[model samples]
Target chain A: MIQYDKISSRDAFGNALLRIAEENPLLVGIGADTTKSMGMQKLSEKYPERVINIGIAEQNMTAVAAGMAATGFQVYAASYAPFSTLRAAEQVRTFIAYPNLDVKIVGGLGGLSGNIEGVTHQGLEDVAVMRSIPNMTVVIPADAASTEVITEEIARIRGPVYLRLGRGAVEKVFDAGYRFQIGKANVLKADGSDAAIICNGAVVARALRAAQLLDANGVKARVIEMPCVKPIDADAVVESAAATGAVITVEEHNIIGGLGSAVAEVLGGRRPSPLLRIGIEDIFTESAPHNDLLDRYGFRPEDMAARIGQFLSSFNSKNEEEA
Target chain B: MIMKSSVAELREAARLIRRDIIDIAYLAEGPSHPGPALSIADILAALYFRVMDADPRNPGWAERDRLVLSKGHACPAVYAALAGRGYFDRAWLTTVRRLGSRLQGHPDMNKTPGIDITSGSLGNGLSLGLGIALALRLLRKNCGVFVILGDGELQEGMIWEAVMAASAQKADNLTAIVDYNHFQSCGGTDEIVPLEPMRAKWESFNWNVFEINGHDMEEIVSRLEMAKRFTGRPTVIIAHTVKGKGVSFMEADNSWHQRIPSKEQYDTAMRELAGGSE
Candidate 1:
């Protein structure tokens, strides 16, 4: 098992941006009244001239970032996930993605992580929106270390990117030895093939914990952590479907068009298999503490493990009886 | 890098650009915004011929001034200017708005050589120009950015946001040209969302405002030159123009906003524009 550390993904992104600023003098940060909350305040403090605050305008922020990027400057637009992805959806699509400019749209407060702030602040549909747009590379880091890694990699990629981040510290899912490729999936546990848990963002650690519980129950399962949601690792998904025959996808977004939908699209195209989508179903969640919301949504490790166990055993027993 | 085009020279160029706008629209075999494109012929002529310090041989030359046609539907005029400037072959004008052509219906920076930024969606060009202007300032390059916004496009809420931000940044390197052509897709802008006391709106936003008759060859060139040198804040030139200046039937007519001219109408437009030739 890999050891875990507690660090806010937003802070990790902010610090990585500072490092990027140190190297890239032309790096510009554009925000819409979300500098401090979205991890851009430090960059503003350090390089006042570099950070161009656009007040409370999200659409203007995204379009302006595209403009800056077109002018040959490395640009990042930060805001709440909903505002950055949906509110500025057309600007991101037309100006940034259509031209394929190298602008990273960093959206904070993804999913139920901002639970206390209610549905308005929560970014439940952002992943779905970003992934659907053509030429947009969608990324959701599992933790601080991975956020830093993805941020560094995103700078090198010469196209538009959407970096979805959550509020507060998340459980670490990787170590110093961990490797991150933009479009490859990382297998945290490959011990068993009874079931495969494919997950991303703040839920990868929970998926790992659930796999451990399945192991204790004498059931071997594989756990895959996917960070790059767009240009997804189709090979990993196909292999997992072939090995386990039962795939479970977990996320902190709407189940309709996120990791579940993306994985299903890959599997339905190549490898047909039984799949279970675990996330916020097609319903708006109410305000609560983040952890309580997780538990309430059946995203707790123990709850997820029980569901996985029931799914595999029930399906297998039916096959056995039929045989 | 320098070409001083006199008023007579600019008038001839504007006449040819007007002819190209009609040619591009008539050749498209579909409805195109000949009205909007015709309105900005003189403005683009002034900028391309005299105002902007851009090299036609090298579209991506560093330190060269940039123009973002925020009102992208007027790309026919811009395409005519770029082709006239030798950015591409004049023969390509026949293939405009056609498949595999670099001159798309809307301005695309990647597909076209001289386009500085891709813009079609309204209220976006000003912010894009501000970004370029800000970057040019940071690099200490004296390159200016010019953005053309339609009168109807000014209704977009985001335009005001950019207008406010541009002033707050004190981006003196940027200049906005409002083609106050009096019409949008549906009808006259005054009949829809009236932006009357136009100069006050920009002045209240802390911009350097200049209103001029957009079709006047001398006034268009001189005022644009003045705006190029104005400093301390962003500038906006509200160039009052008829929607279809050269074509009498289309001018100030709401029905011809994006409608392409029939063969007979095209011939009249061609003859009228050609008559202004020295």
Candidate 2:
């Protein structure tokens, strides 16, 4: 089992950005007074000449980053999830995405990670808004280790990509040795019988635990970690459906236009399956602790397990009824 | 590179742009602000013809300067200047707002070669130009980014946000030219939302201010050159101009904001423009 650590992911991103800044003179970092929050302070401190602190202007920061990118600088505009994605969304759409500029929007506090900050700060709608724009790559790394891997991957890629990291603590799901390719799903546990619980980001660990509970009950649950939501690996999804006949998508993001929706779109087009989406119901969240919010929003291991059980029973009943 | 163009040449180009604006207004289903286009023709000519270090052969060159038409409704004037600049073939001007044409009602950066940003939503170009200027500064490239703001477009809060950011950053490479046509879509700016202290507003935001006759090609060209030459502060050129400059009947007329001229009016406007210069 890979060790999970939030600080580790933060360190990976910070260290990678610093190293990239040092090596690539074209790389410039801009933060909206969240260098410490997003772990960009290391880069900011090390490369003070290259980093720009725009105080609290997320919109201007994003637009300036796009401008810097246009001038041949590899720019990373970092900020809190809500303000960075939604507040400067127009800049992201026109200046960055529409022009397909080489600017990386690294948003901290994805999903309910900013739990203490409440609904106003929680970036539950980031994915939904970002996915609507054309020519955008969206990635949610499951852990800190994956964060480092994906950061390096994005640094090398040419187009616009949104790399979202969570707040508080998160588990590490990869190591220095683990290789990651963009747009490819990672199969954590593979078994053919019961059902496949496909998940991303913080929900990966919860889905794994749910799969383990199902395995004890003679239900061979396969858990897959789909880190990249856009350009989703359709073949893996189709294969999982063919094997299990029932698929459940779990994520910390809302039910609309996120991982679950992307997976459902693929499955709907190719093969029909009994799909149960496990995420926030269509409702705005109130202030609560991280764990409390997850539980309240149906993101706990028990929640996924119960949803999978219901889906399995429903799939069997439907088959029997058809027979 | 030294730019040496005569006033007569610049005025001729402005007159041709005015003619093109009237022509395009007629083509656009008789629903365009032809008068506003005529008003800004001289300033647009000064920039596209005499100022702005841009190459028609390579519009997107890394070291080349940038120009953004923040007052986007006056696009007929811009299209004329761009055609004159040879950024695209002059024939494309006839395809303005037509299907599958680079020329749209407003400038689309993706479609037009010389256009810097897609601006139809008013009060956005200043901020967008700020981004471009900031990028040039970050890259440490010696180039200027100019944005032409309408007197009415200043009603947008984003423009002030950009103005503050530019002043705070001391983005000397950037310059904003307010058409100061003294009118908006509704009516005269003072009658609608008074900005009598327009120069003070920009000066308070920490910008170097220069007010001039926008219709004067010499003044327009000289002030733009000065804005590009000077450093350590962002500059604002508040050019006082008539809304429907060359057209007698439409000048300062609010109805001319988006109305296309009738055949009789077009004939008279064409005669006036043609009678002036080229």
Candidate 3:
């Protein structure tokens, strides 16, 4: 068993931002009254001049970020995922993405992380909305370690990027030495030729655990972490499908227009494999504890393991029947 | 403030910009917001030719004053002004909205010279301008950001949010000019949704409010200059204007908001703009 340190992705993002801002004076942080929640409070406190709190207005905050970007300021604006990607979506699309401005949008509390806040606060559809915009690079880091690396990488990259961060603490999936790239998938564990589990965001650690469970049951599973969903790692996805023959996608987002859809788009053209998507069925989540919501939505490690095992068995039986 | 040119010369420039606006609209052979575009001819002329500190030779000079046409449909007027000020070749005006033309129906900063920001969606420019103002202040760059908004665009809730933010931040380097043409796509602003008490509303937001006749080149220039001198708060110059100022048939007529001129109407408008007999 790997000893996992627990930390929230939002906290990692905040620390990474502060470190980057210290090196680059041109980097400005803007928040829509979500400084504390989005992990910008420390940056705000340290560099009071660089951080702007645009007070509860996501639309204006996005536009302001774009305006600053046009003047050659590397700007990052943060808010709750739903508000950042949906409420201010038009601003993000028009001012930032349309012009391909260098404004990094950090969406905290992505997926069901905003637990107990009910449907409005939860950001289950952020990936769907953000991925649809042209010139928008959508990134969902799997754990706190990767989130820090992703934040540093996005700050170095120029153009519009949507970085989705989770609210709750998650087990560290990557080591401190893990190098982050924008459009590459990180393969965590590859053992079995029976099935492959592709995952991202908060569910990646669970997917790894599921793969472990599958391995013990004599069904070897390959686990791939796809951090960047928009410019998805098509090469990795195709290779995994060709090797494993069956695929299961795990995410904390809606099954539509997310990791599953991205993988399907890749494989439907390149390689045809029986794929099962494990995520929230297209529906809003109710108020509950974050862990309970994760389990109920089929994001738990055991649940994902069981589903992948069932899929592998059915896929193998179908192949044998065809033979 | 020193006047570079006589008010009569500025009036001639405004007249020429109006003429160019009609010419571009006719050549584009597509829908154009002529009413709103014509309405802001004098304002655009004053800003481009007189009030703004910009170099036509070097359009991207770091210290140059910036303008964001929040009401992007009125781009023809800005295009004409940019050409008139020699930001680009005068012949480019004929290619407005043509296939692969730099002058898109709306302002695109990357494609067009002298355009600082891409603005088409309403209620975004003020916030964008506020952001630019903030950056300029932080960089210690002595430049001002001017954003032109349509009165009808005030209907968007985001505009109020920007208004509140601009005031709360005390963006003294920012100035917003509203072309109070009084007409929207559907009908008059009052008929659609009342925006009266507009002056009081701006004042309540802690903005320095200046009301002027948008068509009067002198008033436009003087007020814009006054805004530059006024420090401590951002300024909003409410320039009351007719929907279509020069063309008699289209003036105050909301039907012409997005109307492309027929040959007869176009000829009549060109003649009237040329100070010819009707």
Best by DockQ: 3
Which DockQ-derived CAPRI band holds candidate 2?
medium
> Which whole-number lDDT from 0 to 100 does residue A250 have in model 3?
91
DockQ of each: 0.78, 0.49, 0.86
| lDDT tens digits, residue span A114-206, model 2 | 888888888887887787789888888877778887888889987788888888667666676656777888999986467888898877877
Q: Could you give me the TM-score of model 1 versus the true structure?
A: 0.97
Q: How big is the positional error of residue A19 in model 3, measured in Å on the Cα after superposition?
A: 1.4
Which sequence of candidate numbers ranks them by lDDT, best first?
3, 1, 2
Deviation of model 2 at A285, angstroms: 1.5
TM-score of chain A of 3: 0.97
lDDT of 3 by residue, B77-168 (tens): 99999998888998998888888899998999999999999998887889889889888988899898999999999999998898999888
Q: Kindly provide the TM-score obtained by chain B of candidate 2 when compared with the true chain B.
A: 0.96
CAPRI quality of model 1: medium
The runs of at least 3 residues in candidate 1 whose Cα sits more than 4 Å from the true structure, single-residue gaps closed, are A1-5, A318-323, B276-278
* Candidate 2 local lDDT, residue B82: 87
Highest lDDT: give the candidate number. 3
lDDT by residue (B105-160, candidate 2, tens digit) is 77777788888766655767776787788778767789999888898988877677
lDDT for position A176 in model 3: 68
